[model samples]
Target: MNSCATSFVFLRRSGYAGLLWVLLLSASANTLASPVSGTLSAVGSNTMAGLILRWGEALSQRHPDINLQFQASGSANAPSALITGTTRLGPMSRQMTDTERRAFTQRYGYPPLELKVARDALVVIVHRHNPLAELTRQQVDALFSTTRECGANAAINRWQELPATQDWPFGAIALHGRNSASGTYGLFQQRALCGGEFRPTLSQHPGASAVVAAVGESPGSIGYAGYHHLTPNVKAVSLINAEGQAIALSENSVQSGDYPLSRYLYLYVNAPPEQPLPTAEKALLDLIFSPEGQQIARSAGFVPLSETVRQQQAHW
Candidate 1:
């Protein structure tokens, strides 16, 4: 062959090989970038279930291949589900107890990743028609403390029985509280009831909405629930602090630590995610910490976290 002809043939072969390599790399990248399909299961925290469900609905629009399922029960059940391998994530309204955290670590060989999803204010609620708008810390304690039989005693039921109230509206103080499994119930018992048992007469409801509904439907009824659960039929009562100042619960007040009843909300994930989280599950959790997600939290009546907290939650 002529020298020029041989050189042209070699150059053409090299150009063709380079084009083939480019095509192969592009195909591999496309496969890696494609969406993954799988089911992600989470359980616990009925208080947060509604918000999470809404997020899931929105997430499905963007990630049709991923399947997400959630079960709302008591916060205590979540960690159990994780340890048993029944769920990848657990939603909890309160921080995990030391015992529970230890159990998860022992079973999984690593501690579960903890994420703070939002802030919640535990508010005292009364019937909208009730004239009493606030209660002193002492008065709140007195009402819930079994030491006084406030629940069963008619004498102490009236608003007038409360300190600093002589001419306030008078009526029986019907009490509504959550079931033992509820996180709000635990918090109320520790903070307001002073670890005292609730009165036998105190009505036990299953969830926050039920508690709020019970209080709202009954005249002179009082109860407590997360601020997000409060409705127009029920009014949130200001709590008198140790300083004797009445403080109303609000996102600003709760985030600032001025609201005495405010508490943290958490998401507990098995460390390293036993199985990879479906794209939809990861995206939904990401949205919960995103600016848009925080707005949804706020709209749901919970306190959104600060930017610092949001960033920390995003990593988990």
Candidate 2:
């Protein structure tokens, strides 16, 4: 059998069995052919672009002929690309909406396959010098939204509006956030802003790193970005939980959904019904579902999926 067939057969049986073993064994034993060399391209979430590049680097070490090329436009670009058949892999930070799924189904006569690859959290950050610590949901809504749909009776504009910073010397809170094209923008709008519109004063950025940099530079500024983009120049603010306790971002908290902003990162594939996935895509996914891949996720500052979760999706 060809390398693709061998990988597909093994993956279908083993669920998320690590790809490292298969490649090493095939190379050392010379029983199976090596993975064919070619370029694999993907486009989507800037939040996940770095992680994917890291994975691609690892993949190239094993199959030197295989190269990876991708675009980190925004999560909104992923589904459209998949629909148009421009690319087979679509990495997204948010789940596909009903409309997006419908559009794919209409085009292909089936739904696109969504694979959960990792977990991440959208965190609120302030300049490290800022003494303010925790924020209530109402306060969060008031600070970033024009509609205050999260139930804040009043909008929070200046630093004094928050009781924790009422005596602080800071003036108006400069707001920063992701642009509408980003999945981070949509998720933050849905969860933090309660589906309300952002205030006109909010500075929109193209990527999470940009948002983090802006927050770090401006002493009175506040913004939200993926946890991986965190830096010492900024401090992640804890959110008040339902019990009125402060819940900080941690592996345990985000994994258990204790952190209100926690979310799953996804990779959408244009796998036609009953057809085997393309070799390049399957090999990359095999590595992603492996222990080494999870380690790469941790090193990159994103939470890896647990063993139990991997078992549940073995058929994928």
Best by lDDT: 2
Per-model TM-score on C-alpha atoms: 0.80, 0.85
lDDT of 1: 0.77
List, residue by residue over 64-127, the lDDT tens digit for candidate 2: 7778888988888999999999998999988999999999999999999899988999999999
Cα deviation in Å at residue 59, candidate 2? Answer: 1.3
Which tens-of-lDDT digit does each residue in 182-234 have in candidate 1?
77888888877667677777889877889999999986678888888888999
TM-score of 1: 0.80
Q: What is the Å distance of residue 299 in model 1 from its true position?
A: 3.1
Model 2 clashing-pair count: 0
